[model samples]
Every structure is written in C-alpha cells, then in structure tokens.
Target chain A: MHETAIAKAILDRITDRLNNLHHASNATAVEVRVGEFRNVDPESLSFAFDSLKKEYPTCIACALNLELIETRALCKDGRHEYKASADNAYRCPNCGSAIGTLVSGKELDITKIVVSQNK
Target chain B: MHGPTELHILERLLEDNEQLASHNQEHFDELGLLAVNLMSAPGAGKTSLIKSTAKLMPADCPIAVIEGDMVGELDVERLREDNIPAYQISTGRACHLDAQMVAQLLHTTKLPDCKILFLENVGNLVCPAEFPLGEHLRIVLLSITEGDDKPIKYPVIFHNCDAVIFTKSDLLPFCKFSLEKAKDAISSLNPAVEFFVVSTISGDGLPQWRNWIVEKANKKISHLHIGL
Candidate 1:
C-alpha cells in the first residue's frame, strides 16, 4: 500500500544523485536490501517502482533489485544462533534461553544504482 | 559509449524521514515530553481509548495529542470540544504518518504546554509499523471484533510495538475472539510485550493503561535529568 511512496522516495533520491553526475542519462537498475522484520512486500514494491519510474525519463529503463534478509537471533548466553521465528518465540534454538541480540533482518536500504550515459 | 556505473548510494531508504524524526525527538526531549505513537487498524477504538484515558488521568496531568487521518479535521475538533490541546494532520493520500508530516506539524502547530504527547496514527497495522515518528513508546490496539490471527499474519507490526491493547472487551462474550489464541499468537511473536485488555464502555481496565502512560512519561523525564 505504501510501496508507491517508497518507490517515489527511492527514485527521487537517485534522481537527485543523477542530477550531479556529469553525463549520466539513465539508470538500468536500483538495488535494495529488505529484511524479514520489515513490513515491506518486495513484489508490491517492485510493481510500484515500475509504475512510478515512467514519470522520470532518466529512470525509464530502471529495474528494482530486492534482496531480502532473513531474521536471525543470537542467544543471551552466547551459545546459539538460529533463524528467528514466531514458533520459537525468538529464543535461541539450542538452549531455550533469551534472545541475546538481533543479527541483521531489519534492513531497508538501497545499496547501489546501475547508471549509464550510453545510448 | 560510456559503461554503466554503479553509484554506491548505500543510504537508508527513509533517511529524510528519519532525520526529521531525530529533530522531533530532540525537540521533545528539550521540552521534557514523552511522545507515544498509538496505532491500530480502522475501528479499533483508538479514539474511544483516548476519551477513556482522559477520564482516567489525573486532572493535574498535562497531555496533548496529534491525530492523523487520511483526510478530515473531525477528530481534532472532537478533542477540542473536551478542552484537550490537539493538532490534526490530514495525510490526504498517505496511509501512514511519516516523520516529515510530523515535522511539518511541529513547525505549524503550537502545541499547548503538556508533558505527554499522544500521536494517534492513521489506522493501519502494516504501514505505520514501518515509520518511527520520534516516539518513546509504540502502542497498537486490537479490537475483539478483528479476529485472533492478526498477530500471526502481521508479525512485523505485532513484534515491533512496545505493548498491545485488546480493545472492545465488553463485546467479547458475544463474539468468537479467543483471548488465549490471541495471546498465543502474540507471545509467539513478541514474548516481552506488555498486554492490556480494555473496554472504554465499561471502563474495565483503563487505570492500568493510564498508569502505564504516566510511568513512561515520568521515566522519560528522569532519564533526561540523569543525562544533565
């Protein structure tokens, strides 16, 4: 539902960056890392990105690259690391102890944009 | 022909919103206020919870509100009728209240003197969870009418909030809302979250909710004092 806004934000930021480049005319792809802990739906985000890209002539050929990160948990006792799931109550799988720390899985960032000036 | 180049943007997607949120956080800290972001799906009794809270809070306590909706100033007007200091943010088309809109509100609205600020976000279990609007605590409401599978389906929102309030408790007997099932789903997602079962109509469990807010506010103030 909010993917359109996200797409706009991404394109706007890249567009701003594009303005500063010497001869960059368009982008081929934009890469983003999304985490399992985030509520974003990558499919919806991609669709929104595709739909909104038409407004920016510089991003007409742009494609969205979504890399999803899995949610992981570290045990408080420093003995275990496992995929975090609601089934385990986010606890360490080996010891059944408390969650020590969240390792990754909460990322929502754009890593790189593939841009070019070539026809 | 120039080769395609990779611009390593490596930036947070919501950087602009986050920066403004930080500014709002600093502003709140300077004013010795605790901002709570209250969220829920449509018809979750968020407004009724506020009205009940107003009745339960001590008369001496200073509280203000920022109401967000897709469009309309109706809620702000309703709050003003009760003499509460309030501001309204009509999102127009936005589904959630982002930090930039709140920053805009901060710039335009002169909130009255208050120790606690309740930001009633636009009704959504999904989008609002993605944006952190400079709040000390995030509370999400779930009415009994909504069903028990919400936490399991929307784990991101369920797992992120500090607490969850089960509203419309008075109608529990008439509905199929299984509290145990709901709790099971919630505990599986977030074991440490505080839970409150409330009914604004009967005033079954509002004191605890009201007290929780006060305790959080006081704790925030003490933290600032310690920082000084």
Candidate 2:
C-alpha cells in the first residue's frame, strides 16, 4: 500500500545523486533489493514504480529491477544457520536453545541507479 | 552521447521516513514524552484498548494519543468526548501513517505534558510495519475474532512489534482463537515480544498492562537522564 511512497523516495534519491542533469535524459534502470521480511510485494512495488516513472520525464524510460532476498537466521551456538520460518526460527537445531538471530531478511534498499550519462 | 552509468548505492528504501522518525523522536525526547506506536488490523479493538487504558491508568500518569486514519476524525472526537488530549493525522491515500505525517502532527498540535504518547497507526498489518514513527515502543493488537493465524500471515508486523496484545479476549470461548498457537507462532518470529491477553470490558489484563506502561514510562524518563 505504501509502495508509492517508497518509489517516490527512490526516485528522489536517484534524482539527488544525478546532480543537476539539466537536459532531459531517460533513466536506463533502477536496481533494488527487497528482503523476505520486508513485507513488500515486489510486483506491486514494480507496478508503483512504473506508474510513477511515467509522470517524471527523466524516468519515463526507466526500468525497475528488484532482487528478492531470502530470510536467513543464525542459532546461538553459531553452528546452525538456515532459512527463517514460523516454527523453529530461534531454536538452535543442535543445542536446542532458543536464540535464532536474524542475519538478513529486512533489507529494502535501492542498490544502484543506471542512467544515460548524456546530460 | 554517453553510455548508461551504473551508480552503486546501497540505501534503505524508507530512509527518508526513518530520518524523519528520528527527528520526531528527538522532539519527543525534548518534551519528555515516551511515544508508543499502537498498531493492528482494522477493528482489532485499538480504540477500545486506548479508551480502557485511559480510564484504568493511574490518574497522575498523563497520556496523549495521536490518531492516524485513512480519513475522518471520529477517533479524535471519541477521545475528546473522554476528555483525553489527542491529535489526528489523516492519510487520505496512504494506508499507514509514516513518520513524516506524525512529525506534521507534532508541528501543528500542542500535545499536553504527557508521560506516554500513544500513536495509533492506521489499522493495518502490512504497510505499518514498514514505516516507523519514532516510537519508544511498538504494540500491535490482535483480537480473538481475527483468528490466531494472523501472526503466521502477517509475520512482519508481529516480528517488529515490541509487544503483542490479544484484545477482545472475552470472545475467546466463542471463537476458534488458540492462544497457545498464537504465542508459539509469534515466539518463533520474535521471542522478546511481550504478550498480553485482555478484554477491555472485563478489565482482565488492565492492571498488568497499566503496570507495564508505567514501567516503560519510568524507564524512558530515567534513560533520558542517563542517555540510553
């Protein structure tokens, strides 16, 4: 539901990074990384970006490429690491202690922006 | 005529919101307010919990509420009727209240001197999890009527919450809500989250909940001095 807000933020970020490209030039692509625990529907985010990009002349031709990251968890013993789930998430499979530390699963970031350098 | 240049940048998608959230927190700190973000699905007894808490809390513990909704000011009106200091932020299009909206509320409304500030986010289990509004604590309410599978379905919201409150506990007998299952599902996702089963009408867990709020308030006050 708030994907539009995210998209706008990403566009603003890229615009700021572009640094005064006075003449209009199309954005080639924008790469984003969406983690499993982010609760973002990639399709919806892409749809939002597409709709928003059309309104901006610089991003009209831009393509949004989203890479989904899987949820990963580590146990207390540090010997056990696996994908996170509704069950047995924190429990160390070997030691049987509940201390599953989440390493990565909440990453929602714009990794890179590809744009035509002809400004 | 130049080729495409790939500018490597690893930045959070909601970085702007997070920055504003920090700014909001600084303002809250300046005012000595412990802001708590209240979240849940629509009709998950958020308003009831707020009303009941306000009624049962220790009289001297001043509390304020920031109501967020897609539209309308009904919640603010309700709080006013109860003589509770409250403000409202309506995100007409957005499903959830982000930090910027709450910051806007802070700028416009004169919040009373409060130990605790409850920011009741727009009822949502999904989007609200993605946006933080500079809260000292985050509590998500789930009613028995919503079923126990909510934790399984909305893991993000459940995982991010500092506490999980099962509201409308009186309906536990009539509904198929399994408290144990809900707890198990949530614990696997987040072991540290405190769970409370309460029925505002019955006042079953109000005492414990009230105590928790006071403790949090005290902690925040002490932390303010000690810099935590």
Candidate 3:
C-alpha cells in the first residue's frame, strides 16, 4: 500500500493547495519524485490518481507525473572505496559487509505544480 | 485548442503526507505515547508479541494496534477477540505501509485514549524500513528459523530499528540458530539497539519485555505531562 497511501496523500494535498489558491475553475498538473528504494509501483499510483480524479471533477484534466530516482550504496573496505551495484541487495563489494549506507535513491517529494487559469 | 506542451518539475509530491505525519507525531508526543512500528517477514510472530504485550500492560494503560495486510482482517479479528481495539489498513497491491497510511488510520480510528500504539506493518523487510511512520520506536522481529545471517543480509532494516526482538526462542535448541552470532551481527549494524529474547508459546522472557515497554511508556508520558 505504499503507492496507494503516497498517491492519495499527494492528490489530497494538490486539491487542498488548488482550493486554497481559489482556482475553482482551473486545472493543474503536479509532479512528484519517488525514489527507487521507496518501492512504489508507478502504475498502481496512476490507477489510484484516476479514481481520485473522478471525485474532483475540477481536477479532471490535471496531470500527475512521477519521477523515479535510483540510489546506490557506498562503503569503505580497508581504506579502499567501493560502491554497490544497482541491484536490490546492497552489500560491500570488497568486504561483503552489508553496512553500507544509502547514497541516493530513498527520496519522495512534490517538486512543482502547474496551474492553468484563464487570463 | 492545439498547443505545444511545456514541461514542469513538481517535486515533494509526498509533502502533504509528510505534513500529516508530522502532525501525527505531535499528537503522539502530546499523549506521551511510545508508538512502535514493528516490521518483519511473514510468520515472524509480530501479532503474537502484540497480544502478549497487551495482556501484560497495566489496566489503566491504554494500548491499541493497527494491523497492515494485503487482504484479510485476520489480525484485526484476532486482536479484537482478545478484547483489544485493533484496526486493519488494507494496502491492496501495496507492499509496505508508510507514514501517511498510519496517519489516516489514526484519524479514522479516533483512538486518542491510547497511551501506546502498535503499528504492525505489512510483512516485508525492505520497503517498510524506507518510510518513516513517525514512530518513537521501531522494532524488527526475527525468528530462530529465519537463519542467523538475516542481520548481515538485511542491514538496512537492522540499522533503522531501535530494538530487535528474537522471537520463537524455544526453537533455538533444536535449530542451527546461533544467538551469539546473531547478536554480534545486529550489534555490528546497530550497537545501541536493545534486544529482547522472547517466546510467545513458552512464555519465556515476556515479563521482562513487558516491563521494558512499560518503563519507556511511563517515562514518555511523564515527559509529556511536564511539557504541558
């Protein structure tokens, strides 16, 4: 349910922000970033967004885009630097120690919004 | 209207959920609740521990549980049967539970009276550790049957946990489980994490576990009252 909760939360916030902006007649597009480590299913999120859109007709034309970020692991083995591969299982290549910390992938954010209003 | 589209970047899509999670944490702090998010592989005895803990808690101390699963409400049903207030959050196709889901469940359940809340996250080692549910404590359970290399294999989970509960301890004698090695591996990853060896079936080491939880809960509650 990671994507379900995340998608709902994103859409709910978008609606709130749009409503607060007093753009009752305008549609908007929102982009969100989800890290590869977050293990979110983008397709499921799209499905959820479609369902939510039905309730908020004003957001019928709004577009939701997901940007997936991939992260890797970094560790040191006896003064030697090493990085793990892109695979799910992360471990030190040299020492085989799985204590390597995440270098990038675990991030989820709503970066920007595009609102379409009549001029 | 025919038009060429412009591309825009909207980051922090989960900001709203994060805000709600922050609010939930504030509420938890106010009540002095030590919310523990328990994550593990399937059949790791998370629910069993919940039952034992609930039974051991003092009558005045209120405890509640939120069970996350893919489909059935079996955990919820079992908890309710034991006279505990439990809620089920179905993720459908989702693999793990996040802070927003916990926040929504907290809002819908209206369980302000509880001093301690247990979120039994969906049985998964990888994804659950990635999302912060604003829990004061994160306990990862490992059974003797799961093999001793779990910590070395799943260091991320151990690194994020505040404590580790080695359940099904009674099977240790029969299985090739090495408690010492397991502790060493977990310690190598998270030296500060406390450990509790318990068996729900044998009722071993449960009282000490209960006491530890109660003491922490009481301390948190006192701190909250002082802040007020």
Model 2 earns a TM-score of 0.93
**lDDT of model 2 at residue A100?**
57
* Per-chain TM-score (chain B), model 1: 0.93
Per-residue CA lDDT of model 3 for A1-119, tens digit only, reads: 45666667776766666676543444567777876555567898788877777777657777888777764555533333444332423445666655345565666777766666544
Compose the digit string of candidate 2's lDDT tens values, residues A18-95: 666655456789899988888888888888988888777678788899899987777645647777665644355566
Candidate 3 regions off by >4 Å? A1-105, A108-119, B1-10, B221-228
lDDT of each: 0.83, 0.82, 0.73
Largest DockQ belongs to which candidate?
2
lDDT per residue, candidate 3, B137-197, as tens digits? 7889999999998876666678667789999999999999999988877765555678999
- Candidate 1 chain B lDDT trough over 10 residues, lowest sum: B219-228
Alpha-carbon RMSD, each predicted model? 3.3, 2.9, 5.8
User: Candidate 2's C-alpha lDDT?
Assistant: 0.82
Residue B92 lDDT in model 1?
A: 86
Task: Quote model 3's TM-score.
Answer: 0.68
Q: Is candidate 1 or candidate 3 better by TM-score?
A: 1
Q: Rank the candidates by DockQ, best first.
A: 2, 1, 3
